[model samples]
Target chain A: MVDRPGGNPRAAVVGTGLIGGSVLLRLHRRGLDVTGWDPDTATRAEGRARGIPFPDELADAVRDRDVVFLCGPLSSLPETLLTVAKHTGPDCVLTDVGSTKGGIAGFAAAHGLSDRFVPGHPMAGAERAGLTAAVPDLFDGAAWVLCPAATGIERFRTLAALVIDVFGARVVPMAPDAHDAAAALASHIPHLLAGSLAGAVADADLRDAVLGLAAGSFRDGTRVAGTPAVRTADMLLNNRDQVLAQLGRVTGLLDRLAAALRAGDAVALVGHYQRARELRLALLDRELPPVVRDFPLGGDSDDELAYLLSLGAAGGHLTGCRVAAGTVTYTGHLSTAPA
Target chain B: MVDRPGGNPRAAVVGTGLIGGSVLLRLHRRGLDVTGWDPDTATRAEGRARGIPFPDELADAVRDRDVVFLCGPLSSLPETLLTVAKHTGPDCVLTDVGSTKGGIAGFAAAHGLSDRFVPGHPMAGAERAGLTAAVPDLFDGAAWVLCPAATGIERFRTLAALVIDVFGARVVPMAPDAHDAAAALASHIPHLLAGSLAGAVADADLRDAVLGLAAGSFRDGTRVAGTPAVRTADMLLNNRDQVLAQLGRVTGLLDRLAAALRAGDAVALVGHYQRARELRLALLDRELPPVVRDFPLGGDSDDELAYLLSLGAAGGHLTGCRVAAGTVTYTGHLSTAPA
Candidate 1:
């Protein structure tokens, strides 16, 4: 499968926004035959002006491409996936760069495209937006999640290897629902907290006073609150159940904290913060466990898939894959980085 | 009291922690006759090695100083204040560098020291701790909040001017209770959120998997979780009323957000995030309101004090002050930075 050089993907990105543009740029730089497309004319022209390879038609852009990325907005993803699927080769591996995985996973299952669909969510973002702000290194050292399906194992492995070798991203194999849940904590919660924290200060009796007093904490905490409203809303809405679940857990913690503070319960307050501090210290510790090589990519058994997903759950990441040898590599703690 | 040099007040820092050390360094660099004192023998030795002025006794360190800063831990502030006060000159302006203001403010009031006690909370911090990590620019462009008292007007102006002219800090004149509320939202909440979020992942089903997926949001949001548990607890307890109150407001916001996610309410979710986005944008915008000069520091009236607190509430900051001219200046919005 390492057929035409720079390793295995003849790819096409269907959206020219930040995520898609970034993927396109990274792949193109890696000497991959990567084509770009966007139905929006202005974006297409901008891509052209920026020297990104843009073929005239969507079908032509995707034709014969082994990897076809459907990078449309959440509202348009289902249709865009179906449309792009019509243009791609039968052996093509389909994927997306969305934050949420369940919606696309469901759409693929319903349409019987799970065999070809390898659901993905790149765990990366920047403060800026659009094609102009996209950079090739956006995915460098970032987690590019691949939610495996029952039959997409071969293509999934192929793409995961290329994602690792080409872009230097860590391939985290997860189940669709699992991806949603973890994302709710790692990615979505920041948006929720950002919105909530920023909202509280907006209603502050002294707005400038609060803002003036806002230092690195407030700035870093609310960084995501600046994300475009429509995009943030769609992400939260699509992963509603998981987001709601995680939000419930976090709010419970915050409630107990408030109670502790209200009662001036020294032990309770200290215990609450100390738990987090210790966990954080563990998470942040530099001395991680040894690398475990050759976590199998051979069989598509439920046991194998579960093991792979469990590795991700345990904070293990695929540093690289010995694809031809039918295995991947990981560097992880037995439990967490600190542990 | 520009008697010994730089700009004003022969200043002295009573404790040589991060805050005190930074103040000492900044003032010392500005050519002031500043001395440092630390009860801890090792810390005093460290200060000496670092070329920070460390007179042998606490009384000598503060002797005849026009301004004295009590920079001990929250637990030591009261006694430290009394001890330091005994050694200072009659006209000395006593202040502190604590995050929460109400405790010491109450102490000043109860002890009849309100006339000299100018409660201050410098809105600055560093990732590292102690004299080893101290830097002079820590408070540059940061808010040095001085919670106004009925009788501390003259000394308050004297110290506020030195805070501005010497260290380039903006003196935010707030009431003690108000300072606590703002600090709760700005400082304490970050610690709460960090610990809660970190705790959630530590107990994840596949700890490593959740840990693997954690990114910039997780890092920044949980940044404060790394703060020492004892200190975090003390700060929270010291500002219990305000921290609990702000925590209630924030948790209420989070609960509503979870409800929006649970209901899959598009408008509600979008509206929630959009409100934050709008406020964040407003807070982040570079174009600010006109400066209001001569906000009287001469008057200690109820109305003048209220007006000062209101200025902070509206997101207004003092760019500079004209101390001898009996006025401070401001750069603020009518309501919020966005407003």
Candidate 2:
């Protein structure tokens, strides 16, 4: 790791899983001294094993630390931030790595610590989390959105620049309300949509079949559904208003498209695809530096039905194997028996 | 190799890439004498290089083959099927692994090949394609959807059973319309959305920035957009009606949610997410057997943007060194990247 430049203040990151671990790695690579905290002992141990120092107490982690980064679940942010606020140094800054900002900002204000808090989100993560999952190059060239909570302009700019310097991420300053709304459209709603889709096909047998047939389309569409349940519930419950608003827009889009199809209006239908295409492209153009994903591949797996989860094995021939009487024998290694 | 029980029907797979190559793998594994063909000489040569013999012509491939599989671009399917229909043996059964069925089925009937054609879709494939990219285990437990013409019940069923035995996939039969509509929703529309998103961010600079901060949410939201341009255009152009219909539905959903946000209708917004969650869950529960995925890392990648552009990067993840600094360094023993 590069040595931090003179006057570069240290930052404390709480909950060193995917998000926190990534923040820690990015901060460290950019030469910022980072101290991490995770309630999960194993997760903390893993972080320690990876050579990232872990603080046992919230106060110990944040005290005198130039900035405190709350990189935990959305639901946990309010209480944890509140707890941090109680013991924080008045001059020290505080921020969060939560996806939804409005609710957390509100929580900060309710606890009378709004001036010290600046909510931010780095729009990046992978399918894995934890300290061992940490990589120093996590946030290079990503968009780190900051939603200041009535914090002074100097403080916000300082925090934002610090993020840019430490994570190599661009700073996009947004109001907490706007941040929540934007995230509802871009992130929260998508998660809820995926969860809903997963919930809809709750049938074990159907899930087994679906998982096999689930190509990129299904996988992409339902990826967010794999986020831990606690995070899902936190975002759903905390940013209820913004998420609901975004959901309404999505449903509206679905209805319009469905109506066009029902009406047999091919022109109208194509227009919708074109519009969606444009919107999606616009969203994608806003690149984010890669980071370890906060969410794990969620849901209970059926070990018995695991045999049924075939991937891309159709309409193609299998090499080194032949089938006879409905069983396959292969020349190369076989991972598992067919369901 | 498993012995082909008494006269295991000979089969032919045309267009040996992704779907076609995979079809060959499964069939060969099942002990069928599988012949392969592709218009691209290099692809055919790669198959040959890999010990997968490629027939010089379609007729040469399927002359005595009991089952003929057409696995090519959607636009090419009609013409290819027409050519095959003229020379295919009267007893030979013909099936296609196209994304859309309505157009192909319509084209077959127009070409006087209706009775011989059974439209099918193997719900699988990577953003990557080609014979060299083929895997023997591509369709082990995915869904192989078949849309049989009215008079070809027995032939379709036999083909379906063969698919099951070969790929270890579930044979799901549905009316062509249902299959087409569902494909439009699950596959076609998603592709269009991804492309649209990619298109919006076509600006190289923005793409670079957005990609760095990009997390799984954006990647999943835009995964299908990485589909090849020709194939993407063909899918949209051929299934224009269904794709357009679905686009309208999605746009409507977007609009409604936008309006709800404007109106601050928290209740409506939450309801929408709840409903979408249900739909996603329902999708997850459905069992589709015989599909296979070749990616061992499950789609996370360090150079995903480059990979999506068809750069061969070992499927996912960077094993050693940083691409950020413009050099490919091997820190440890590295396997050659996937072709």
Candidate 3:
């Protein structure tokens, strides 16, 4: 793998789902020789239809590939890694995009494949899933965590960095346990909270009223609850200890707020909220670059011009100007900085 | 008050904050004879600067108004409503925009003012607060809940409906107790959850790491945590019983999920998440109409025209046409519908 320093390396991705297919597409777009293998016929056909090269046999896809990516669901990662280990060439660098890193690292260590494996998790996903949900920019600007095992080879890092660069992701390295713990607090717990909040409404007799009255706060707070259940369960079980610990911390906070409410101790309740508000503000201060998207204008009438101006001023950073071919384009930042 | 059927009514808004100033601005936009009063000197100054008529004495603002809106914080609403009852004429309609309706209704009933009061909770807010944060379109397309007291007069309903219509809000009527309960699950509990999630990060030694990796899910999930602490505390304490009840339900769901994780029972965990996901999707499926806004273009250059087209094509329903003053304006819907 080290011999291909300035050249596009051969890559194979197992499981052509959202994460995997996205990696394949992004790598392909970046001019890599990529191949894919998935168990499902429909997924494989879909990948092929999207111009992704699919090898009929798993071993054929894995063999001689400089890098092998196990981008399957958490439940299937261990088996997929084993298949990669058995089929990949001696110099191949193994990586994965599973939500949890600890379990995958442990499996690789136990199988004596630790040196060749780099357990990575992309902190980016959509509520949608599968091949159709795959996008080339899915991992752009996302944090891509690489928890390299103690015995992992440097080549694995190099290969992983190259793939991450293709996806335009920022690489973050941490110990496997630390990665799991941080993820539990930042991602897993939020999902649990979203689901639990939604569940509370589901169990309420006034479900219709509650849903109707739900505003931006409720909608945003429960957005993750719409994610696929099996995927969430897989991540939760894979990172059980850390998820449980974070859940305990959150529950304790909830209890304190509840107590303050019961005692009519507005000062104490305000203190808790103030601290949380400060923390949220601090988190928001970490800024990212603006998101810009382009559009084409079709008409040149007064109504068309009014419509364009309306679109530009529609509660965001949209601005526009005319271009060639009677086209008008606009650039705007999509994300709103916290107030 | 009933003498003005289609005519603009005389209205007064107490507490010149975001909600209050917005009401004043929108009502003024609708050609109402509006006046405002606030205990805070700075807020009152800001409102006056925005062209809102203000009286130095609270009673003076309330005296001749056909409707008096107590738009203060939850803690201040009782006193404000008492002031309105003391000065307003017999036919005047009374209302308040407190998050929790039951407390306000109880206070009104105790003061023999229940018949004139229609407690409301607007399902709209911003992270920003105060007079500068007020916008004429703040309540547009938002749900304006009217938890009218049992003894509330018909005039109150009529006046509230007119105000709601002016704000372009959809009016939803419910019993005070029912409104409180529903709001606990839909709004208050969600805020508590957001705060708790942020609080968990605050307590962690890896706070920076967690925050850095916090993606769309965490950001959206914790957005309400950025809201002012005193306001949240007031709302929580005002609806203590319902808030506690909803918290209890959320905790129960969390406990079940934790138990399933501990047992490594994927089936049980999946069931909990599946039910939640279904509930969330159902809630989201209750669609609302799109929100449209307009922007005015400055120049007629090809580059400017291109910009307009690009703006129109950016991930929304954007369209534009030429208008007076060489303006090429565009119209775009602001919010995305559920996928």
What DockQ does each prediction reach against the true complex? Answer: 0.66, 0.09, 0.28
TM-score of 3: 0.81
Top-down TM-score ranking: 1, 3, 2
Number of the top-ranking candidate, with lDDT as the measure: 1
- The digit string of per-residue lDDT tens for model 2 on B211-289 reads 3334567667666655545565566566767666555555555456446555656576556655555545444443212
Measured over all alpha carbons after superposition, the RMSD of each candidate to the real structure, in angstroms, is 3.0, 19.1, 15.6
- Compose the digit string of candidate 2's lDDT tens values, residues A139-253: 6755567653323433554575676555666555556675566565556655644544444333222332233245668768766665555555556567767666455555555
**Comparing 2 and 3 on DockQ, the stronger one:** 3
Worst lDDT run of 10 residues, candidate 1 chain A, spans A329-338
Comparing 1 with 2 on DockQ, the higher-scoring candidate is 1
* True interface contacts reproduced, per candidate: 0.73, 0.18, 0.72
In the range B87-173, model 3's lDDT, one tens digit per residue, is 988789888888988777888788887678887788889777898888989988777776533354354346445745578776555
Better of 1 and 3 by lDDT: 1
Tens digit per residue, CA lDDT, model 1, B1-339: 634445456778988778888888888888777878988889888888867678879988888788898988898999988888887766888999988888888887888888888899888886567777789999887878887655766666667777877888877778787777777777888778777887776666645666678777777778888777788888888888777777777778887887877887889988888888877787677454555655565444566566667766655555555544555554433432236
* Worst ten in a row by lDDT for model 1 chain B: B329-338
Candidate 2 ranges with C-alpha deviation above 4 Å: A1-68, A71-83, A91-93, A100-118, A122-214, A225-339, B1-5, B25-31, B106-115, B203-209, B246-248, B285-339
CA shift at A281, candidate 2, in angstroms? 11
Candidate 1, DockQ to 2 decimals?
0.66
